[model samples]
Target: MSVIKVAIVGANGKVGRLLVSQLKNNNSFSTPLAIVRTQDQFNYFKNEAGVDASLTDIENSSVSEIAEAIKGYDAVVFSAGAGGKAVERIFTVDLDGCCKVVEACEKVGIKRFIVVSALKAEDREFWCNIKGLREYYIAKKAADREVRDSKLGYTILQPGSLELNKGTGLLQPLNKIEEKASNNYSINREDVASFIVQSLLHPDATVKKTISLVNGDEPIEKFIQSL
Candidate 1:
């Protein structure tokens, strides 16, 4: 089988790191491109993770740099995010940065993209009136809109509050949970990573829709094989 090549834009992040590790271990992929921001991050993955991840700019790199990073990959994962509530950075990185990469991917003919977003984003009036994170989601919603129109094969995962638990691989896309039930149904980063990989490998799953991911007890490997 010809292994697919994928590029991870935010390769040093919690979710991004886990996905990077998974992609590295999978024989189905050509070595993935890991995009990083700082020297510290570049060194961390190079030394600690012991992966073939390459450093590229997610913060200050030119649009051409991003284009070059993903030029030959079969899929590109938009894991880059602007930390904290800084709404300005939200539009810049999460929205515009992603848009720039998508344009680059299109220019280079990379057809697959997986973007990680938040759940319950449409009802963000609660967060936007005050919280900075909520404002960030507003930008994500717009970015989602752009991906919908990109004519690219895309999978958007909208997980709730992220957790650090083990990856069971079962993703429960439940409807609005009761406020009290929201204790820790949050998903682990690994689960999200597995979903990213599965979405890329599966040909029948809906491409342009946003799917919610949450804690579940099913085996993810089984899910992937079934696909």
Candidate 2:
């Protein structure tokens, strides 16, 4: 038996780093692959984060430029985020870029797909809702719609407020809330990464399912599998 190969898009982000760490030690996976941004990121991510393996880099590359680099993976995680860029840029990456990657995945016959998305993307006043933030959410939702209908095995994770935290593996999926609800929750980026990886390995995983996540004290794997 061979360890499964996985690819991580936006492999330099917060959750991306944690994804790399989790994959390196997992028995079922090879060192998860990364589609990185710049030359600087290639070194920093590998050296600082310990993602060494047959990893490839598409530095400052567009989504279209990613196909050859990610050609032979079992799964691709879309963790590419806007990083406070212009609204237009956010649309370009979060929405259009994601679609392009999915197209590439189809072209190369890659079957498993996982997406990192925001929890309340459909709301008008989502927290941390800055000028272009709503646009970001809209774009992610549009891409999510595409994946659900694309006939591929896909999992879309819409996690609640993202916050700075040291890694903790405990995870809890959030209950779907109405758009006008006043409650809130935050998830550690590491836990978010773990959920994405687990979804990739499980064939019976939540395919065609879009789930929301929040920090919980329960074991992360059980919490997700029960969903």
Candidate 3:
């Protein structure tokens, strides 16, 4: 099989960092193009992670500018975020930025797009009731909608509360759970990153599907195949 060249937006973020690391370790994926917002971020990925990177301020860049930056890659990962509680920044980075990435991908004829979204984004009423997180959810929901409606082959992974602990390489498809238990939620950041790389490598895992993720007993590959 031919290797897939991927451009990771927000490659400096926590999950992005792990995704780059995992991709480097896997032979199926090419050395990812780490997309960041500033020169400093580009340097960090180059010097620290030894990955090729470029600067594209997503908040300000037009669809064409973003598309130009990611022109040759086979796929793009939309993991960039504002990383704060600020409402405006949330919309800018999560909603508008995600839409731009999708539009850019479509413009360039790159059909494989992966997005990391929050759990329960589909349930707006639940998120809106939770203080301080309404804006974030709103942004994610909007971005997710855009991807779902687009013609691109897309996978939206909606992992629950994220933990910084080491990955277990195990997970459960949320749809498989018979009961909507809260304990079924929550997954390690490392596992989430691994899943993203696995999903890219295994296109059948969750293509054109939005999956809810949580830590569970099933092996990652099996779980993905079952989906």
Candidate 4:
């Protein structure tokens, strides 16, 4: 089979960097198009991660401009985010930016799209109870809705709290979680990248599924296959 070509938005971010690294090292995926906003980011992926990239300011670009930037890739991953606590950025980066990505993918005819969302984003009660996280969750929720509504083959991964630790290669699909049981909510960024790679290489494993993830005892491949 031919290698899958991918375009990753926000390729300089924490998870984006990891995803670029993993995809480059793995044989299943081709060297991805690392989309970034600035020269520093383009250099970071080229020099540090050793991947090919393009410069496109997603927040400032139109949907058509973004679409042209990512054309010719087999798939796209929406991993961009606004790192600060800015309320306006939540809408711009998380909601509007992702919606633009969806539009770009649709225009370019790249049907395979993977989105990295946060856990409990679909839960209105969870958003209401969380302090100072409502806007972020709201943005994530809105973006996820747009991806699902689009006419594309998409997998929406809603991972729990993320940490910058080593991957365990183990995870728990939230659907398998026992009700009312205390679950470990933190997951390594590397593991999340691993799951995205697996989902990309094994479309049957996650196509059209919105899965919640957390660090658990089941091996990553096994858990994904089980889904």
Candidate 5:
């Protein structure tokens, strides 16, 4: 029951904030470090959320600088994204930012890495028909590939459309997920955060795996064990 030390990139984002709160309350981990872009964000996480915070902008930092930010943590979670505000960010934040973090992990010898990726990112045909998302999907696909090719032990959690609903603590089996149309694949952000916690706790089940997540009847632990 040794406590794990975790650092979360994009700590100011929705999923990142939930993860920081969950980790602080869970005995399995230390107060997770929240890596943020601004002094204001750093202050919010440190003061309001009661966690350690580091001011590190993933979009602008070099691999070495990012490595320095996350230096001593046992695990690193990459949940940062461009949020679709700009097309250029699709390349910089989603694709290149992910690569930089993977390289940073390698530079520092950190093995455990978890990435929040998009559902169906690997299937080009699936996203090709969707308007306005081609670039985003492309970035996600490349980022997922970068994580796979890296030496770091990685778990890529490709959850469906992120919703702000409450956590159900359940997930549809990955095999059954594809049976439905892509439109039905949405999951709550809270559930995604919970799954992230479970993934961190049970690295034996999650490391080096890419899992598809959506709300369902089976408990998170059961779904994890079934893996």
Candidate 6:
């Protein structure tokens, strides 16, 4: 139960920002390392957010370089993504970027890895028909597979449509959710961030598991116990 030093790869994103704040405020964790792609982001996380910041672009940096940046951290979280309609970026940032992070973690001997992936990415039939999102899901599926196949203790969180609502600190396992037919699965980004914290805190229960997330009535702590 020592203080865990965490390095978050996408600290500038919505959920990533929330994670940085939560981890920083928690006594169980040391200052979280924010790995960002630009100097502006680096400054924000370092001078403003008061956390260690690394200017490393996952899409451009070599695996060796990334390993160097993340070395000595107890865990690494891969939440970076190419957020937009740029199809080419989906391959570079979403796919190759994730693979490189996995390689970097392995090289550095960092075993605790968490990934933020899309819901239903495992079911190709479900995402393939969704217009404009097939490539993103394809990248996510491949990235998820790489993590599962790696030697690290990995947890892949697949959350449904992300929303901006306040986090209720509550969740429901995908399989237990009864409104699957409605196809309106979604969760707040803050809730997803909370779940990541819970996963990191309870690796024994979450390691090697890919859990689907959606906002519900169950508290995060209790929901994690059920995992």
**Number of backbone collisions per candidate, in order?**
0, 2, 0, 0, 0, 0
Runs in model 5 with CA error above 4 Å? Answer: 179-183
lDDT for each residue of candidate 5 in 1-227, tens digit (9 for 90 to 100): 68999999988899999998999999999889999999999999988999999998889999999999899899999999999889999899989999999999999989999999999899999898889999999999999999999999999999888899888898889878965456569899999999999998898999999999988778999999999
- Candidate 4 per-residue lDDT over residues 65-142, each given as its tens digit: 999999999999999999855899989998999999999999999999999999878989877767888889999998
Q: State model 6's lDDT.
A: 0.91
Give one digit per residue, the lDDT tens place, for model 6 in 1-227.
79999999989999999999999999989999999999999999989999999999998999999999999999999999999758999999989999999999999999999999988789999899888898999999999999899999999999988998898888875557657436567789999988888888999999999998987778998888888
Error of 2 at 222 (Å): 2.6
Off by over 4 Å in 2: 46-64, 122-132, 173-183
* Model 3, runs deviating above 4 Å: 176-181
Select the stronger candidate by TM-score from 4 and 5: 5
TM-scores, all models, native as reference:
0.87, 0.84, 0.95, 0.95, 0.97, 0.97
lDDT of 2 by residue, 13-57 (tens): 888877887888899998777677677787776777666432333
Candidate 4's TM-score: 0.95
lDDT of 2: 0.74
Clashing pairs in model 2, backbone N/Cα/C closer than 3 A: 37-59, 37-60
Q: Record all residue pairs in model 6 with backbone atoms less than 3 Å apart, i.e. clashing.
A: none
CA lDDT, candidate 1, residue 11: 89
lDDT of 1 by residue, 11-42 (tens): 88889999988888999986677788788887
Against the unseen true structure, what C-alpha lDDT does each candidate score? 0.77, 0.74, 0.89, 0.88, 0.92, 0.91
Worst 10 residues of 1 by lDDT: 173-182
Residues 89-174 of candidate 3: C-alpha lDDT, one tens digit per residue? 99999999999999999999999999999987988876888778888998999999999999899999898878899999988766
Model 6 TM-score? 0.97
Q: How close to the true structure is residue 226 of candidate 2, measured as C-alpha lDDT?
A: 78
